[model samples]
Target: MNQVLTQKPHDMLAATLSNEMAAVNTLIQTRMASEHAPRIPEVTAHLVEAGGKRLRPMLTLATARLCGYSGDNHVKLAATVEFIHTATLLHDDVVDESGQRRGRPTANLLWDNKSSVLVGDYLFARSFQLMVETGSLRVLDILANASATIAEGEVLQMTAASDLATDEAIYLQVVRGKTAALFSAATQAGGVIAGAPETQVDALFAYGDALGVAFQIADDLLDYQGDSTATGKNVGDDFRERKLTLPVIKAVAQATAEERAFWMRTIEKGRQDEGDLNHALALMDKYDTLSATRRDAMEWVTKAQDALTALPNDPIRQMLHDLADYVVARLA
Candidate 1:
């Protein structure tokens, strides 16, 4: 057989869905515009065009196409997913007090927090309008539930932040809420719009859920070990912020009493000093938590790929499987 090399899996997926994605971008631009409040578009545009991978929307389009859908509503749903994702990001940057996003200053930093918040709210309302235009109440329900879950997850993370008692189970719950909920919703809405069989829809949901968890786990791991230019944030941002992500959580689980006190002083009490991040990294290295976290991420990747077996045997299915592996491949 002739072998053909390709770009990254997401780039290949984007090439496959270029036409639909173009439509989604057009719709996003059109919907993000506000006649009276020009700042809405200004702030929204800053973040929306920040070169995000648009992976969530692509999931919607790919799943719909995989199920043999032949309608324009898929485009609408794809745009809807993007809007929801963008809205949450705007809110997140403000809440996290983040200074950077997508390798640029965050909207909250460039513009005011007020602008980011109101624009995010505007995009959210616009997202509802787009989904309603699809004429599928079920699609509306899935995205709506996802929006709620995202908010709940952010709230949960706020409460769990810097708390040494936070465990793996709580970490997973927060991950599912903040990250996986929208992923599953995007895929599930696409399948539902295509009128796919219950089994296939379930599989799509499972695949998205697992992929999202894996994606988040990889991101958390990167915080301690990744290049700043590639990750778009300084290494140890999570540690400096006192956010107890999975790698730290794993290390905490195996901490000796003295080690536990270190975590408590830095994370729980928020009294971090110079060289504290290095000390924390050394402790995680001592427990080998980074490798353990990578293993957990790989397990989720397997689950995501396994879910694809229930879907049709199409090229898109293969791309979806590759995408799952690519997410974890970042760790390498």
Candidate 2:
């Protein structure tokens, strides 16, 4: 059997789009500064300087280039996408009550939730200001809707997180709102900014939506199986948090009465023992939900790749396709 080598899609994207990415980073630094409040810059810089793949902004830059855009607004738009993403992370860490992010102390932990929340609001405001500079109502609409959708997804997850009744459809809805909304908006706005044809623009949206779904599913799956060092997350973190991610949802769907009782005790009641994580993994293994979840992630990846078929046959398009595959390949 041939062992498949895992490819680094974001590295390829960064290498190819280095110039535009540099412009985006510069703009990010410029906009994140606040003269009225030094603390705002401090909080923003802490998270921004932390090494993230900048995948969302790269998607904006790459899609704009793929559509043959030669204008300057794409850089601003790319920065806008990144600010929104970073802001979301700030808010998410606060909500998750997490101590670590990107293997560093979370901003909320270092400073306070108030700082993280206010700074996140500031970033969101800056993102809106930057998007408005594009002078495209369509771009504003798409990004605004995505921001709202992301908030709604977070709220939905709040209600659904520990509920055993949460189904796969509800899970996908949450994924689409929280993760895929920004991705689809990123690509869609890029195409719109470039004045690409409607078909190509829609194709870009589809590709992004599918790619985001695949990415989130892979991340959720990794919470159970990934190396803590490599993933910057402890295994079974979601289980411990009672997030009701896909694998656990699958396992819950097929859970026997006794297994369901265990889930109810641990997840619904907020009581967990040291052995609970191992037992959850054992149940998942018994049900083979991990493999089933991996299959679902691959299906989304294929959907993402298929959506790229409508795009131009170019290196950018090929990179996008490979990116979709590499999302799931992290699981392998």
Candidate 3:
């Protein structure tokens, strides 16, 4: 994707967001390069150099700046969050057996799984050390709890995948675990580091949680209908992998006997050597699973906007508020 063209946004705020994201690229690069470990930079850079939105770090920096933070600690906090995120991607690639990420081979694909695992661990340790430098036990507490939640969420996803019995409640819990926890931590840490009032901190966290939920929901919906170029992953990866996402769960909620059997055969039984992909797509369309999931994502986008109403009405905060809306708009 052309990074320069990202400046084209329907709303002016998105333009600024594009620039803010670009501004953090260097900070991310410098922090990921380590002088000590011989291969640490290579592994860490493998993940970091692969372009992510850097959304987590941007959230930290934008929140701190929006809240009138004058000190430079937010930079450290932002870099810390990026490190944590990169670590998760390394571990996640190994767990998912993913060959491609950001259109490049995954760390586990380029090197051995052992190397990816070890590098991920080292990044985690480096993140902890970075947090300690801030001297804010509160920040550590928030991130430590977030780290645990992220791990538990990943475990939940692993266990839940291919489990036909998975329901809406379980899906939401999994989403919170896998995506919302880090988003909440990133924004909450911003407020905590910036010394924002507790109420504002709470508001930022609530906003982030809702935004993350909507983002994940959109992702689930797109797995069924998104352009492969835009999303980078294949259309049926989630389905083929047997992970029951929101769309499938919603469809399953109202599935008939044959549709249920179809799901069982394709998703659970893994008997998809035949043309099950077409059958699964037809079933998803018949049930309007894509539409239903998209609606859920939109609802959360509204809820996310509502959460931001309590924040001070400033350009930055309002942009963030708009950002929540922007996240799901593309999927629409």
Candidate 3 residue lDDT tens string, 190-274: 8889898888899889988888899888888887888789988888889888999998898888899988998898888877876
In the order shown, the candidates' Cα RMSDs to the true structure are: 1.7, 1.5, 3.1
At residue 173, candidate 2 shows an lDDT of: 90
In candidate 1, the residue pairs with backbone N, CA or C atoms under 3 Å apart (3 or more residues apart, or in different chains) clash, namely none
Worst 10 residues of 2 by lDDT: 1-10
Once fitted onto the true fold, the runs of candidate 2 whose alpha carbons sit more than 4 angstroms away are: 1-7
Whole-model lDDT values for every prediction: 0.92, 0.92, 0.81
lDDT of 1 by residue, 47-127 (tens): 877879999999999999999999999999999889988989999999999999989999999988998898889888999
TM-score of each: 0.98, 0.98, 0.92
Off by over 4 Å in 3: 1-27
Instruction: Please tell me which model should have the higher TM-score, number 1 or number 3.
Output: 1
Cand. 2 Cα-lDDT = 0.92
True-structure Cα RMSD, model 3: 3.1
What TM-score quantifies how close candidate 3 is to the native fold?
0.92
Candidate 1 segments exceeding 4 Å error: 1-6
